[model samples]
Target chain A: MKNIPGDLKFLSSHEWARVESDGTITIGISDHAQDLLGDIVFVELPEVGQTLDAETDAAIVESVKAASDVYSPLSGEVMEVNSLLEDQPEIINTSPYEDGWFYKLTPSDLSELDNLLSPEDYSDVCED
Target chain B: MNKTPLYDAHIKLGAKMVNFSNWEMPISYSSLIEEHNAVRNAVGVFDVSHMSIFDFDGGDQVAFFEKIFANDVKKISKGNKAIYGALLNEKGGILDDLIIYNANDKFRLVSNCSTRNQNRQWFEKHAVEFGVKVIERSDMGILAIQGPEAMSKILAIKEIHAEANNLQSFGCMFDDDRLYAKTGYTGEDGLELIVPNMAINDLWDQALEVGCVPIGLGARDTLRLEAGLNLYGNDMTINNHPYESNLGWTIDMSDESRQFIGKDALLSIDQSKSQKIVGVILRDRGILRSGYEITHEQGKGEVLSGSFSPTLQSSIGLARVDQGYQENGKVFIRNKALNIEFVSPRFIRKVKMQP
Candidate 1:
């Protein structure tokens, strides 16, 4: 079983969303997602200031096995993208939650978090 | 999915299993990069038992192979040697690429698992006229011990150490039910062992005890790509011929009197008009994947096998492009056409490393 931090909200596609104290929502793939992708070689991050729709492709993660699209959990304007992942994409494999966050965005509607799956619900999804 | 004899062993080693050509095989144990480097710098063992192996025997065995195989098997029939060649259809299309080993009284042909059924049918269809018996050796398991230190590590095995010690490249030695061949898909000095399924687990354990790192299909792929070896279905298929698949060398047309399966159709093909497989290095970021389009000065083609090469630390691929395409081309990944430098299909050769 993979770790599903209780503090975060998740999409069925495996993206996790955590609302920061500053009101910006941080996004990254879940531990289960990285484990399934295996040995990430490249990461394509969304551009800062770009508007993204909920449940849309916001980034791409390429592993030796295959390439996968990382979707946005909620509609938002990209605030800051992780520039460090440009050189060290494997960080997502090692630390998917903290250091490997893909990007942060200012949500068009903060209430959208309620529509996302909770930690418990996401864990069940992973199990299936 | 079908499971190999080493399924339990792979599970015990915490391997990440995946479905490959209908077989449940390990994709990686720890990491693809780490396993790839292990085979490049040290020694690594791969459970390649998923590949199909067939044995040929009878009075007309040699004649049967000469009629169906593209390469001249007569060259290796004299000694304990192995020759790489392609099985072709009457239309000059490649059926499969395999290695044929001269195992004393009998010949052993190892081929890809994906084309097992079709290859068997093709072999059987042709064997009848030559009065040869084509037997599938499904009870045997194959292990590829590769890397710079592969030879020394395999020599640690006590059973056939002396016999395999002085084996030359493309050479093979058989001991009862076991066969050891100094050939591998990875462009590294290694030994490929064919052993009975009952004793495969013990051999795998011995390989690990001898300091050989356990590798999975993931690294096996990257290693072979780095070595410029072609994957059967990816690089060549029923729609392709040896002339276009960078395997023209495997075909021998010297003996005009010898007419193989595809000899007539291959002879009629305009060599200068055929698209050829070439190596492409991405000048931009991101990985290259199969089916990506390539636009050259002459025409467009597609990537056959593409991936990020761990050895080169850059993205590289084998692409079939127009016959007139030159040194540089552009590959369309997504909506953008990125610059790519074309070179010989082979990306790397065996690098002598310190033991």
Candidate 2:
């Protein structure tokens, strides 16, 4: 079974959002998502200060087999992006939940977090 | 979907199974890079049983092959040897690329699984007129052991070591119904063993016990791409001829007396004006993939097969471009034109891991 951290909220597309103490939302792909896209070789992250709408394409993750789009779970402004992934994209495969976070966002609407899936719900989604 | 004889073994090893040409085959066991590196630096085994095999016999066998196959079978007919070539239509378009093996009285042909039905139909349509009997051997399984240490690992197997000891490259040794050929698709020294379906599990187990890593189709694609080999469906198809597909060397035009199926059309076409396949290496950060548009000095073309080359630590691809296009070019990926370097279609030859 894949790990679905209780502290995080998820989109059905498999992006995880964690609300930071300062009202910022941290986003990354779920462990199940990384497992499906094996051996990620390239990661194209969104630029800082960019505005993103809810459920829009925010990033791209490429494996040897194919490329996939990483969707944004909520409308937000990109505050920070993962620079380490520019050189070491395989880190997403190794530390997807921790050091492999894609970006941090300052949310336009905090109420959108409630619309996301809970840990138990996300686990059920992964099972299916 | 169909399953190979080693399907249970692949499942037991936690392989990621995928559908490939109506067959449920393993796409990756652990990871694509690991499996690809294993084949480049060490020994790896592949369950290539999905490929189709056919046998030819009868008095008209030699004459029939001379009329159909692009390569000269008579050159390898005496000894137990093999030759790679293509089956073409009357317009010189490739029907399929295959390897033909001369096993003394009978000849063997190995072809892609995707074109199995079509190839059978084409063969049957012409076989009756030539008095040749074409028989499909669906009861057989093929295993390929490849890498720098492939020969040593295979020699450790006791069953047919003696027969395989003196086998040369492109040579074969038959022990009863089993065929051991010193040939492989990967650019490495290895053996392709054809055995009965019932005995495949035993052979696979022995190979695993002897330190051969089980490779899946994901790594198989990367390995073949790094070697600059062509995939049947991706690189060549019925609309392509030998010259455009970088397979001109496989055709034998020396024997004008032999009126092969595609000889007349091939002779009529001018080689200098045809588009050709070439290798391209990305100088940018992103990966190259198929269907990407390319703009060159002479003309425009598209990528045929592209992937992240694990061996080269860079992205490489095969692109079909106009004849005058050479050296450096630009490939458009997502509306951004990135610089690329063009080289010979083959990327590696007889590559071994450096100690």
Q: Any idea what lDDT model 2 has?
A: 0.89
How well does candidate 2 reproduce the true complex, by DockQ? 0.93
Q: B1-355 in candidate 1: lDDT tens per residue?
A: 8999999999999999999989999999999999999999999999999999999768598889999999998888886888898999999999899999986666899999999999999899889998888999999999999999998888898765578978888888898878898899888999899999999999999999999999999999998888778899898998999999988888898888898999999999998998899999999998999999999998989998999899899999999888888888999988888999998767886832111
Q: Which tens-of-lDDT digit does each residue in B1-355 have in candidate 2? A: 8999999999999999999999999999999899999999999999999999998767588788888899888877785888888899999999999988877566888999999999999998889888988899999999999999888999898775576867778888678888888888778888899999999999999999999999999999988888888899899999999999988988997877988899998998889998889999999989899999988888988899998999889999999988777688999988888999899867875832110
How high is the lDDT of residue A29 in model 2?
93
Each model's DockQ score: 0.89, 0.93
Candidate 2's C-alpha runs over 4 A off are B351-355
Q: Candidate 1: where is the Cα deviation over 4 Å? A: B351-355
Models 1 onward score TM values of 0.98, 0.97
Q: What is the lDDT of residue B267 in candidate 1?
A: 90
Q: Worst lDDT window (10 residues) for model 2 chain B?
A: B346-355
User: Candidate 2: TM-score?
Assistant: 0.97
Error of 1 at B237 (Å): 0.6
